[model samples]
Target: MEPMIWRQAEQALAGLLAARFTKDIIRKAEERMRADVHGTLPRWISAWQRLPQTGSLDLEATRQTSAVVVSNAEPIDLEPLTRLLMEFHPWRKGPFEIFGTRIDTEWRSDWKWNRMAEKLEFRGKKILDVGCGNGYYGWKMLAEGADFVLGCDPFLLYVMQFEVFRKYAPQPHRHFVLPLGDTDLPDRMQCFDLCLSMGVLYHRSGPIDHLQKMHGTLKPGGQLLLETLVIESDQPAVLVPKGRYAKMRNVWFIPSVAMLEIWLERTGFEDIRILDVSTTTEEEQRRTPWMTFESLADFLDPQDPRKTVEGYPAPRRAMLLAVARK
Candidate 1:
């Protein structure tokens, strides 16, 4: 069989990203796709090949709905379809409905989109989404009238999950999720109209450097929507967890909202606004059938919901909007 990985993404990037960056990005992505040694890849690929093709579904209807719903005019057997989708388990970032089967993901990512969608406009904009899990928000952005969306996530499983959707969507070329992260992006490309770095900052050891890289990728006056875990403090304070916070081993710096603003300013971003800061709730993130792994509820102290099992303040996230200053 012909290569199924990164083929459409490579084609889409040819027209979307700058020529200076396109070749290098595609080259590296292709290399990663080829070098995969994961044992589950073959099983995932087999499952992808068996998915029933729905010819020309109404893509417009998805724009008005919350879920990425794809339906055929005629009913098809859902039992096998659901099982095929289950092959790529642990859906982290969406609540997608393929045919009639609802894949209730770990995160109610739609809730996050609803919070930020009113403040922003996506009409005809070129967007770059860093750490885009399963490209869930990319579809939401497309629904909001984005010209094109290029998303990158280092996790190959998320990339495969995206492929499941891309396999059935009518216009697959408009959105893509490459198996790469922010660091893999070309240097000083300065091409996108909007850059999104949501739920990714605290994972980076150098949060400031990550912000600077995001700043460099956008055109002058381009907008950036950054969301990350923040500690509540009147003063500029940050928690550098000596060990796991909320049962997550990768978390590094959980800064105050005030400190996050300073990081954006120092990284050449202006018009900084803290759009929303909300504590994560079990209703928003929990163990679901689609995602059977431990969730936010498991990470918190059963005795005290306010504190994590490690005694740090529980996961409180903040959304910030700013513009790249040349």
Candidate 2:
């Protein structure tokens, strides 16, 4: 059998097995990688393989620009590179600049990052990002001085999308996106300094169990940075969607900030702090050239923007910071 395309990633992961992760953790990660059954795996791998390689590319995440920028001292052809990148279409989570080609993704994720950047500290912290779409936030965290970031999302396309950037990354091993979900993580491993669950809570059928899993992943006193869909309500309340919310079938629960805090408190997290609560606007998440599919605009009701097509409350999100109890 031919060697797997992600053999290098596995090797890089192996280097961390003894120092940072348990053997079981590494085993599960590798197993996930090896057990690829996605129909688009071959095409995504081909697109990733065809990406242009460069030497000593500069990777920068500047305050001046929202896009994760990658530039080479020597110029490269933008046309072919842009075409190659477009193979992994529906780019959902990034606004990246590779060489001179700009990939304007579906969500302006930088806006979400900026909301909480000033309040949080990432220096020297090891982070685990659940539902880390294409590892965009991982790079942003690293730029803010995170020591290491391990991202997991069950979506195979997002994992392959990360591979495209990983190819040209100056330090590829600093961040890795495994094709695993929160449920795949070993219980009570307690290895990371921080755990991030962004845009994932509502999709979970059991939100409290998801929070508890995140709490268990962190070391004693480690932090949990959670960002999820929330409704505007003063009291503890939740919206259990009858069918679909915002055109998403997996969205099971949309809780108010009060209810979210209660979930954290009940899941062994302390010092709960609400960082940011903002209404998700079309400008923040809309269709772009790189991602042409239906977006926030399509999900909202045409006559009443405040409600979804299904007559539920429109999308609102909140960022919360909490410390895992020792």
Candidate 3:
């Protein structure tokens, strides 16, 4: 079936007085929409018209068919989608805005927010900001009373951003440092009370391998606060052909929720929890209409707990924020 928003638009267009119009004009409009356009507007119109009165559309049931093939399309830039969500519907303060990025309302709706606050409030806790882009979260932790906060990133560009933050918002114990990768950390192994490993796992060729190294830096019983894109289904998966990862060779895989759970277990982590999050918006849905490889716009809805694209049927999208004890 077509998107509800587009269907409503089509219905509004159909109901308009057409005495000033002729059959030829309508035919030409349909022709233009269908002939070599990025999306098939005519087909969408037909689906929209049929949607209301149909016996049983059963979109959820239709998703499980054996013939379904996951779409391999690249996501259009997510910034527009994020911006759209931020503008129209505000995600309340629990998870709230990370700098400008939209995320879940509460970072941990299941876990005690006060417990997290306590961890952040620890008077002399050492913190490591892994892939700490601009150290936004790092600075927040520092302000919350962490005794020491060290932000690390492989990218020199981001390291420079951290430097800028240090110069303007200097803190006695908070410092930003650069590490090229696992091998570059200082000789004495330092343990941290909390590790912010957000938005870094999906961009790697071997996520766990890097994660294990990150885990090595933490003290026993240290907490790893992780956030990354994740798949939702139980079935084992395959990478999309010619997918976005192809554009960036270092991009490896996005793990499923279950896979991540197992990885944490194998790596000796305990008390793991998965948080469902969406990072897309309505205006974003409008600006980049071609992002759907197989009618995937629906998966972008923040309210829906399940993450899967339309037509393709696989659980292709979601944000996973998990915390595990080391």
Pick the lDDT winner: 1
Q: Local distance difference test, per candidate? A: 0.86, 0.84, 0.44
**31-129: candidate 1 lDDT, tens digit per residue:** 666535667777887888888867333347656766787777778798998899999998888888888778899999989989999999999999999
Ranking by lDDT: 1, 2, 3
Q: In model 2, which regions exceed 4 Å deviation? A: 1-22, 34-36, 55-57, 61-64
Q: Judging by lDDT, tell me the better candidate of 1 and 2.
A: 1
* Model 3: colliding residue pairs: 94-105, 95-105, 95-106
lDDT of each residue in 1-326, candidate 3, tens digit only: 22232233233333321322223323333333342552433433332343212132111221232111112133334465354333322222123222233344312321223324433344567777677654545555554556666666665434433432343343232444443444344332435666767667777677767677667666777777776665546754534324433133344566667777777777657777554444433322222221223222434334452433222223233433334453
Query: What lDDT score is found at residue 140 in candidate 1?
Result: 85
Better of 1 and 3 by lDDT: 1
lDDT of 2 by residue, 1-326 (tens): 12443455566556444434555555566566553656677787777767766733244443347877777788888888888888999899978888878899999999998987888999898889999999988888887788788899988889888877777666545788888889987778687899999999999999999998999889999999999999889999999989989899999989999999999999999999999999999999999999999999999999999999999999999999999999
Q: Candidate 2: which pairs clash?
A: none
Query: Looking at model 1, which ten-residue stretch has the lowest summed lDDT?
Result: 53-62
For residue 129, give model 2's deviation from the true position in Å.
Answer: 0.5
Quote the lDDT for 63 in model 1: 68
